[model samples]
Target: MQQRTLDILDKVLYGLIIALFVVIPFSEAGINIFAGLILIVLVATFVITRSVRGLDRGIWQPILALLIAGLLSLFFAADKGRGLHKFLSPLVKYVTVFVAVALTARTDSRRRWLTAIMLVTGLISAGYGIYQYGWLSIRRVYSFSYNPNVVAGYFAVLTALSVGLLTGVKSRLWQFVFSCTTLLGLGATVVTFSRGAIIGLVASGFVLFTMLMSKAKNKKAVLVVSLIICVVLVALTPDMLFQRFRQIADLENSSNRQRILLWQTAWDMFLDSPIVGQGPGGFSAQYEKFRLPGAGDFVSAHSVFLQVLAELGLLGFGACLWLGVLICRVIYAQLSTSDQDLEFGISLGTLLAAVTVLIHGLVDTAFLRTLVGTSMCCLAGLAYSIGLHHKDESSETVSP
Candidate 1:
């Protein structure tokens, strides 16, 4: 009877996770609802199972520190109530999703199932983007997302996942499928015309290809096909895409100038509060006071690292950095010892997804958006879980 109850809770948790990936792209309310359900089920599962065995508990330490920093920053917040709400709500959502995935997805097949759902979600979003571009003549496709950059960043991660899947899956049929999705995702990313997204996609793609080159048997064929697709995409791209490249070096570019000004203001805010920061949601509220002369109207700092510095100060920023380093260390260890192709696929896909988002985050709030951050936390959770559950006799260790 106990076993049956545990099985039922596991299935429910998995279903909610699937719901989260599917609805997050389309509806914010849906994400909230599904995430809440997952949290409830996760609690029940934890109590009934009466154990946290096989879950990677190490990743939680840095996350806990970051949360503590955020909570403490509220002491200096302009509006303490808003700061507390802002800080805790998303943190709870991110932690809930991470815990749900890490605990529920115990087996390799279960992990792959989650990835498959993510791929399907990406494909659906990409298809919508293609439709918007081809039929509506939209120059930049945002699809269901709020901004073209957000959709582009999302696709950059998906494209990396597809590349990882291409080499990781053993079956020829699945490889072909992943290849098709890769091209589709890339096409959608191109239509978005997001410069940061493109750069991140390229960086992650290079990593994925390099990893595959060392392991996969059909490396030459994959390289040839990928190059051919790249050439075709370049030829078919609109003049606006080329214009974006040309404007890259031009500091006077409207958006580029704005980001520079915002970054300057962020530095000033950091100087004012070298620790703890202005508090959660404080950057936008306090941005005008710190705004530089001739700066345009803006709410966000437009860069994740700068925004964190302005809002959280150095202590919170350090905690965030520590969290990132811990995650990277966990992934590195997993990738180093992964003997199975399945583990390779999960680790590579997770790594590329993270790297792509982080690269994009350098120039934009890629990791701060609700959906993106949640996705990122979940990916890290998946990698951490895989590392913990790895069947090898040797145990993986991370030093403090």
Candidate 2:
């Protein structure tokens, strides 16, 4: 009876995870609803099992550090209520989603199912964006998100992940599916006309090709195929979009100037309270005071790293850095030890996804947004779960 109950709860938990991923691109409220349900199920599972046996300590340590820093920064926040709210909703909520999915997805079959769901949902979202661009005559496709840049960043991560899966997976069918996903993702990302996201996609793609080429059997094929794809994507790009790309380095561009101003304001905020900074959500509260003359009002610092430095100070920023380092270590370790199988593909995909978010985050709020942040956390957790599974399998093999 107990086993049956556990099995039922497991199914429910997995169902909620699938729902969360499907809703990510379409609705924010849905994300909250499903994430809340996932947490409830996770808590119930812990109560019934009375064990947190498979949780990875290495990853959780940095996660805990970040939470601690956020909590501590709340004391120094300009508005304690706002700080507390930010801490709990995004910080605590995102961590809950990460740990829940990581703990529940303990099998290869489960991981594959989750990956397929992500691919399908990503395809749907990108397809819609393409429709908006071509049929609806939208200038820049935002899909369901408020900002085109946000969706672009989201698509950029998916594009890199799809490419990684394409290179790493062994099945021709799965490769073809990922190939379609990559093309749609690339198309949607370009239509959004987000310079930061495009730059991130390029950077992450370079990293992905480089890593895959190192272990790839047919190096020339990889290089030739990659170049051909680039050429095709460029040739297919609309003239207006091509002009937008050319404006990235133009200092006279209005958007670029505004971004420069926002970055400066963020730096000033960081320098003001270098230790703990102004606390969670501090950037917005302090923006007016630090805004340069003629600078327009804005909420976010526009860069994840700058925002962290401004809000949490060096302490919080350092905790974030620590978490990033640990994540990279785990992914790299798995890549080094694993064969060119599905697990390797998943790990490679996760690594490039992180790369996309981090690179885009340099000039935009990539990881700070709900959609992108939650998605990245889920992917990271899945990678950690895979690592734990590998460890468990090794232990079972060695045991009598």
- Deviating ranges (above 4 Å) for candidate 2: 1-9, 43-51, 216-218
Model 1 agreement with the true structure over 59-89: per-residue lDDT tens digits: 6687778888888888898878878776865
- In model 2, the Cα lDDT at residue 99 comes to 85
RMSD of 1: 3.8
> Which candidate achieves the best lDDT against the true structure?
2
Residue pairs that clash (backbone atoms under 3 angstroms), model 1:
none
Best by TM-score: 2
What clash count goes with each model?
0, 0
Q: Write the per-residue lDDT of candidate 2 for residues 88-109, one digit (tens) a residue.
A: 7678878888887788788989
Off by over 4 Å in 1: 1-8, 43-53, 209-233, 391-400
TM-score of each: 0.89, 0.94
State the TM-score for model 1: 0.89
